[model samples]
Target: MTGKRATQLALLGVVILLVAGLVTGAIGAAITGRDPLLPTPGIHLAPQLITGEARGETTKEVFSTDFVLTNTILSSLITSVLLVGLFWLGTSRLKVVPGRLQSMLELIVEGLLGFMESVIGAARSRSLLPLIATIFLFVLFNAWLGLIPIYQSFGITRWTDLSLTELSKAHVTDVKGKPTITVEDLKHVVEAREAAAISASGKSEAAVEKEAHKFAETNRIEITDAGTIGKQLVVDGNPVTVEGQRYAGKAAEKIQEAGGKVKTAQAGLSAAFLRPAGTDFNMPLALAIISFFFIEILGLRALGLGYLSKFNFIGSLLRFKLIDAFVRFLELVSELVRLLSFTFRLFGNMAAGEILVLLSAFLVPFVITDIVYGLELFVGLIQAVVFAGLTIVFAAVAVAGHEEEGHTAAPEHKQPEHGGGHS
Candidate 1:
């Protein structure tokens, strides 16, 4: 087949797949009696250690773990390993004429080095290349990794429950002479149900009784509301299900066995096993800290003790020039502010981009999601470049001493005596 025809055929295949996905998702939602668009995609603010638990238990402790492991940390480690492996593979064998992988690596390094030279000059760029290049590549790779289906769709299960106070605060009314709990109150009920399950599992009486006491503290309410609270659970980064049927927990099972269905409860919060590293505050904050320390160290190494003058407003204050001292203090403050700016810029953009993609995919799966993925790719690269470029600029500025800008020795000039020049 001609190249053009071949390309057209490939495009046709992709279109067919996307259409199939959309149809599948739509049909699934219809059969389930749930609006695919109504549910917000799961995105957790904090990482969860355990995968599953009963939601809404009054017992404060849900799962047992000695240490915390966040999705961000996992992604960072993965990114680091991938980056090292990639560079090693690409450069392991030096070639007179580069292969595709080696050529691509060289092109990227050379382009970035050239850009750094323009900003900070050649000498410093070489010294700073390792830090700058690593930051750029790491951020870019992590952001792109998030766009992959596996990263978004693979995660651990987490169960979250509301506090007793929250349940007590819920509105209640009477239904058929029985105190009826509304849909809102059902979330609080899950806590009791979970405790009961633990008790039924033949745990210590003290353990079960402790949970019972906590449950007792929760004020009871009538089920005046027609609908039951829906329990949200995630397994494997997608909604929990088995054989085309949603997974039912103990509470759900009991209700279903009694010929009833749940219709109005919140899902348990589940943290994905791998989140984009850049989306986490910890990643950017750590990067910012490293950049700030490096910038300071570069200044000190380049200018020695004189580097202190960058923040030394006390000298101006002693000279009785309050305005100059205040201005210098503001400059010092700006240095600290740079840390905040760097952290927020990276974290905010990455996190927001991820959220936007999630929303778009939910609202219009398949086509718009692909488009958003493309946009994220561009955004990720741009963010990485911006971060690396700023680091280089800051390093350059820091190392350019105050004396270099304001004071320099003049070159010696030769002068001849007016009367002796001829002799």
Candidate 2:
């Protein structure tokens, strides 16, 4: 096919797919009684095949398995393995006339080395290439991997419990010996109940919250004695009962059936099996720590114990130069701040992008999601380059500290000599 014709055909196919997806999603929503635009992306701290117990119960101890494999860790490991395999295969045999893989590797290495050389010079760039390149490739792979739809879809089922106190404050009735939840408290109660149910059923918390809001807006909550409350209370014009003190809901029922204390369950729910690796704060923090450590090591190797002087304001303090000391103190603060900067920048960008993609997919399904996927690809590449580039710049600054100090001292030495010569 001609290139222009091929492009037109691709666009046609995408339009058809989007139309089909929209129709299918709308039909599914109608059948399921759920909103087609509501996203069910699970957000979790850790990935686990099974959840242990609901939090907030002082009476019982909840313990999960010794180790649960999380998606972040899984993604990191996979990225590392792929990087190793690619480099190994590319460099395995010496090539007089390089093959495609070898040429690609050479191009990437040469490009990075040339860039680093411009900042830190050719000698130091070669030494720093392994660390810089590994970080770039690993982060790049992770960013791209997250764009894959499978990461958002598949995961294990887990349950969370809710406490009554968490839902709302209780008014203790002296005669019936039952706590009555007020109308104001009912919204919170229902939301907690709904969230638990939805999460346990492997739906997203976003969807749960949306449903809870809709239910709360439509319904009014009332509590009275079992005799006066009737068979059910009217909620959003529908009758819902309290079987005892608990709300008549699937979440409450599940808790009761699971032999869990339902005096109001705690908020625990099922989530996606894995969160994107870059979204986890620890991943970026770990990378920052590693980068900083290596930067320090490179500084130490280049300038020995003299590198400590870059941070120490002791000389300024002893000399009674308050301004110098203040500047030095600021420098110290900036050094520490770099860790936070590195950690948050990567985490925030990646996490926000992942969330954006999820929201877009939920709102528009096939069409808009594809556009977001492309944006994420660009964002991922930019982030990887930024991270690696910053590390190189920092390394350059760290190692050049002595040289900077010498340059500063030279002018001082020259000034005295020029004054002496004039005298």
Candidate 3:
């Protein structure tokens, strides 16, 4: 008892010191206006390209067709391999008395089956188990595996002079001497561009002039709406183009490290090769498309030609019942909108969770971020459950006509026992 009590007290002391240190360190940094231990993370809406000549480039928009492959694509492939390997290992060598992996697999399958049976029916649940179960596992694995340290830490590097919008268009390689731009130089260009925009917006000339002066000590430069000042812009007679937004961050870091010039800086970037698949809009959108088709197909299978009546207003039109036709049209619109709803819902949640964990780590590195990671893990499971649960509910609604909503109670049914013969 004495030794255990001593150990407890020691652990308590360590925790106390940790909290105190974090608080004091944060306070000191705030008061002194110092940079946080970790640099502010850049939030990207689009996944970084990992293949093709444009690899390492990222776009501002979530939807882009220019890239061949991205980090998120690789992450999805990894998730697929993991899911296949895991189930294969669990089922390949089953015994009468199951091993740990087999037991875990059974537990997961049984729980999912029970959940589905509650929503739809025992027979229907068993029939649709493969689709719903695969989605849940895929999403869950993608989220959980992303938390591994290497997913965020290891990746290709980005250089300062490279084209931000499309790496294939970068002119540095074609130019002689690789004429380098400084961080200060980029800052002036950005500020000039902003001042021009503000001036064009009919701001007071004096205010625009003052802003321009603060941005640059030389003659005020004007940037066109197309992001170019003029064709005359050149370094050593080679034309140079700059993306102010990209230069505002990682490029700035490189220039600062290179003593204001990217020519001498070692590469420093944080574009991980394996980001979570959920962070990419494409992944969630693909899943939603699959779910949509499955739901419609299941409805058709159950109701036959009658299922078409849900969206078809032609009968009402023939009867001249305008109100009924309009209402059915609304329902049709709502049904189609579910595709976008599913896509954005999952994408937003996963992206937000990723950002939360990243910002927490940047603001307060170790202990606090670990706590956030735990919360994110719970959130991940919740998202997977929500996604899978909603899919089952929708499937039930599709197959059960309009009466499913009015039915308060799911009918009692016997859960099929997993017999030893299967194992």
Score residue 363 of candidate 1 by CA lDDT: 58
lDDT for each residue of candidate 1 in 129-207, tens digit (9 for 90 to 100): 9999999999899998888877855643334433323332332223332324444345434455645555656799898
TM-score of 3: 0.68
Tens digit of lDDT per residue, candidate 2, span 1-423? 699999999999998978766665644566667644342343443332322333432221123543544557767777778789999999999598999999999999998889889999988888889899888888898898778777655543222232334322332222353434443445555556545544555667788778667766644443221110111122343333222123333444443353333332212123344456898888999999999898889989999998877567788789996555556676779988998999899998998898888666655578877888899999999999999999999988888865586787567545654665686
lDDT of 3 at 313: 75
Between prediction 2 and prediction 3, the one with superior lDDT is: 3
Candidate 3 lDDT by residue in tens digits, 329-365: 7678988899899989899989998998877766655
Ranking by lDDT: 3, 1, 2
Ranking by TM-score: 3, 1, 2
Q: Pick the candidate with the highest TM-score.
A: 3
How high is the CA lDDT of each candidate model?
A: 0.66, 0.64, 0.66
By TM-score, is 1 or 3 better?
3
Q: How many backbone clashes does every candidate have? A: 15, 10, 0
Give each model a TM-score. 0.66, 0.65, 0.68
